[model samples]
Target: MDTMRDRLAPVLTRLLDGDPRVAVLLAEIGADGFTEAGRRHPDRVINVGIREQLLVGAAAGLALTGLRPVVHTFASFLVERPFEQVKLDLGHQGVGAVLVSAAASYDWPAGGYTHMAPGDVALLGTLDGWTVHVPGHPDEAETLLRHAVAAGDDKVYVRLSLLSNGDALPVDGARFRTVREGRAGVVVAVGPTLDDVLTATQGLDVTVLYATTVRPFDAAAVRRAAGAGRADVVLVEPYLAGTSTAAVNDALTGVPHRVLGLGVGRRELRRYGTAAEHTAAHGLDPRSLRERIGGFLGAAARH
Candidate 1:
């Protein structure tokens, strides 16, 4: 039951050792995991001691010098805190880097709202030309990480989560993988929500799409799944609710379609609880999802 973060150190260490152009910038979070990598390549592995802005700025600087930079931190600090830098230093400057994030949504509920960033993905949607990878399993994370590193001056965000599916499905890091096929509608599961989505949609007639790469919004895949008719799409993301709803709407443009976006709710829960509790509170648990999905698709579901 190793989380994606558990796989980061080794996979990144291998990447750093094998490629001379790969550099990592950290903001004191997960810096301990890269001790060996820092020792092996002092100039490449850098920790800016809690300066999240500097972490992104330095990564952008490295990218400008023809180096591929992998920046790591919690979702909030990585994307939200230094967002201005992410927008200007990287996007505006036209530099490319790999932004890897941990602590998906409310993974560490005790850490409170400051550490939780359900809006990270939605916030990044404002920028252009960015590739977003939300890996459901550790294996998928490694695969997407490698792809991001070798993207050749393309902006990529590899969002690693403490949550994961029971197994790793085949992910090309470019398109969505169809886990199951049906005709009634399509349930697009982004990253770790695949397991719950599978469970929630059982005994129901609907297509299940597993999306590791979300930014490009695999429109063609959904179009293919929905076929040449009125499409019903349910986007289950692990971030802010309706984060991908607009994208789904845009994808189904000109075709009659209805979309239901489910994920962490906008209402802030003021209690400190386990991640499981948070999931249920947000109506993202399997049972709640079953009811919602069944109601939306107008199909009776069995647990």
Candidate 2:
């Protein structure tokens, strides 16, 4: 099974060929993947060396010239290291660009903490008018990538990951799709966490929602999924814990709702272990999630 990162080059290549306005900017990361595209459209496909700041600034500059720039790099360098450029270059200028990131969370554990960006989504949440998409499967990633590029000068962020679900859910990259329906609670799974969430919530009486596009956070869908009684929501994100807690709370305004935000913890583990080890340490594995989700919902039911 190909990872989301594996799909980036082919999809972007197709987009670049089809759309004249589409441009790709890289920071020496994943430059080899675009060799053919760069040869075909040298002006559109640019590699600005190892400078992460230039990657974003150049994308914004291209957007300024009426071209839709799709920027690529690791999550940490693309979003965290050059965050100021993301904010001012694109946000402040009111220009649009597609910032597609690779290596979600602890995808490259051996690369150290600098490569791991568990807070990328949360950090981007601080900015306004940005659409965030965390696709669970490569198919979903391709769908969201095309959606972002064709969005007509809208600021978009497409998060790619080495982690993927067993199967792809039919997602249009706009709204949340209902995977399962129940009455006890609602489990909103983001990106690669969907498979784990499904495993954890199996046989539990709860509505499971698959969200690829998180930013315009489907508040109405969440409200409807919560049913007419007490809302017990467990947001299982692949990023920082409680990243979407505020959005869930606001969705249930004036209503009784209990939200349990389960994700990558703030404590950084210094050991260079495998990504699976990191997932277990963060308490985001299927076993840990099952225990936590059950306890949270069971406790709410008792009250």
- In order of listing, the candidates' clash counts read 0, 0
User: Which prediction has the highest lDDT against the true structure?
Assistant: 2
Clashing pairs in 2: none
Report the error of model 2 at residue 50, Å. Answer: 0.6
The digit string of per-residue lDDT tens for model 2 on 160-267 reads 999999999888878999998888899999999999998988888889999999998999999999977779999999999999999999999988998999999999
Q: Please list the residue runs of candidate 1 whose C-alpha ends up more than 4 Å from where it truly belongs after superposition.
A: 299-303
Check candidate 1 and list the clashing pairs.
none
lDDT of 1: 0.92
Quote each prediction's TM-score. Answer: 0.97, 0.98
Candidate 1 weakest lDDT stretch, 10 residues? 294-303
TM-score of 2: 0.98
| Segments of candidate 2 deviating more than 4 angstroms | 299-303
lDDT per residue as tens, model 1, 1-303: 777898888888999999999998898899999998899999999999989999999999999999999999999999999999999999999999999999989999999999899999999999999999999999999889889999999999999888889899888888999999888889999999999999988888889999999999999998899899988899999999999999889888899999999999999998969999999999988999988988998842222
